[model samples]
Target: MDLNLRKAILSNIESNDQKQLEATIVEAIQNGEEKMLPGLGVLFELIWKQSDEQDKQEMINALEQGVKQETTG
Candidate 1:
């Protein structure tokens, strides 16, 4: 089967307003389904690609803190 996941997801969300996008992301995370991971990954890819160095560093720092919290707390 041929598939274009990223294209399809982008198309699906293209018209979404900020609230709609937030709801979609929140619902996906709250549901915690494995099937939703690819969509979340695509969203993360979009964020990463658009971020500048400082933004990327902040994201990395936040991720590091999250990992540390997970391990230590």
Candidate 2:
């Protein structure tokens, strides 16, 4: 069986509006199930693809800070 997980994730959310997208993300995160990780990865991939260099840098910076806090706190 051939499965395109990224395509499936995109298709599932293609019709969502901004609020719906926010809700989806928030709900998935709150649930914290391993199955939701792939969907979040797809969303992050889309965001990364669409981001400009500055935006990418900002995300990296935020991620670095988050990692540091997690490790040190």
Candidate 3:
């Protein structure tokens, strides 16, 4: 990750009051959000780190094949 982005995240975390974070967490949990506010950023980071162009292409190809097979069947 870029140093600036890391710093910005740290800064945002540091800047937010704890009560607000707790409220946000409560809302996310209560609403059954697939992605909690806190985890969304980390989830994005993980996906970005793990997927390359080639991996994306392979995934698209697999999906295309599955669709074709379904249609033919």
Candidate 4:
């Protein structure tokens, strides 16, 4: 069986409002389940595709800082 995770995730959340989207994201992260990773990755992919160069750079910087914090803390 071939499953398109990105499509599935997008379809599921396509009609969500800001509050609903925030709740979904918060629930997924707070659940801390590995199954949610693909959904988060798809979300990130969407954000990356929509972001301008400066936004992308800021995201990279934040990721770098997060990685460093994880390693050092």
Judging by lDDT against the true structure, name the best candidate.
2
Instruction: Report the C-alpha lDDT of model 3 over 1-73, residue by residue, as the tens digit.
Output: 4467555555655556779766655676698776465454653464567999998788679879999998999
Task: Compute the lDDT of residue 31 as modeled in candidate 4.
Answer: 100
The local distance difference test score of model 1 is 0.95
lDDT of 1 by residue, 1-73 (tens): 7889999999999999999989989999999999999999998999999999999999999999999998999
Clashing pairs in 4: none
- Report the poorest 10 consecutive residues by lDDT, candidate 2: 40-49
> Of the pair 1 and 2, which is ahead by TM-score?
2
How well does each candidate superpose onto the true structure, as a TM-score? 0.88, 0.93, 0.33, 0.92
Listed per candidate, the RMSD to the true structure in angstroms reads: 1.2, 0.9, 10.5, 1.0
User: Which structure is stronger by lDDT: 1 or 4?
Assistant: 1
Off by over 4 Å in 4: none
Q: lDDT (0-100) at residue 52 of candidate 2?
A: 100
Per-structure clash totals for the candidates: 0, 0, 0, 0
Judged by TM-score relative to the true structure, which candidate is superior, 1 or 4? 4
**For residues 1-73, could you state the per-residue lDDT of candidate 4 as single tens digits?**
9988789999999999999988988999999999999998888898899999999999999999999998999
| Candidate 2 per-residue C-alpha lDDT over 1-73 given as tens digits, one digit per residue, 9 for 90 to 100 | 9999989999999999999999999999999999999999999998999999999999999999999998999
Candidate with more favorable, higher lDDT: 2 or 3: 2
Candidate order, TM-score descending? 2, 4, 1, 3
